[model samples]
Target: MNITILYFARIKEVVNYSSEQVSLPDEVETIIALKSWLSNRGETWQKLFSGSGVVRAAINHELVDDMATFDEGDEVAFFPPVTGG
Candidate 1:
């Protein structure tokens, strides 16, 4: 499926791009699956996406959990947790 993946904060710097269009293989079904898939891309990908790391995600601008389902043309975002005091 086609999806737009966005990076924020340090993730953006690590990935070297703010966002990119990706065509995910059929095997990827959820946010966690997507993270695993990206981690397999290469060193840069692996470094940026830690399987057990605490990364926040949003599907179509709505914050979602790892179990969230996504479809073709969906906009997915990866970012660090936001903190304010």
Candidate 2:
């Protein structure tokens, strides 16, 4: 599927961009899987997405859990968890 991934905060710095479109391989099925796949791409991707670091995802502007499924043209964003007081 073709999805748009938007990066935020420190992740944006590591990826060097705010967003980009990526074509997922057939094996990728959920948001968590997508993140794992992205981390496999290269060093930069690995660092930002490595381990269990806090990252938030939104599908088509609506925030969703990491288990959310995606399809073609879906906009999936990866960002750090937000905090406000």
Across residues 1-85, which tens digit of lDDT does each residue of candidate 1 receive? 9999999997898778899999888988699899889888798888766645578999999999988989999999999888768
TM-score each candidate: 0.86, 0.85
- The worst-scoring run of ten residues by lDDT in candidate 1 lies at 45-54
lDDT of 2 at 67: 87
lDDT of 2 by residue, 1-85 (tens): 7788888887787788898988888888798899899888797788766656788889888899978998889888888887668
lDDT of 2: 0.83
Considering only N, C-alpha and C atoms within 3 Å, which residue pairs clash in candidate 2? none
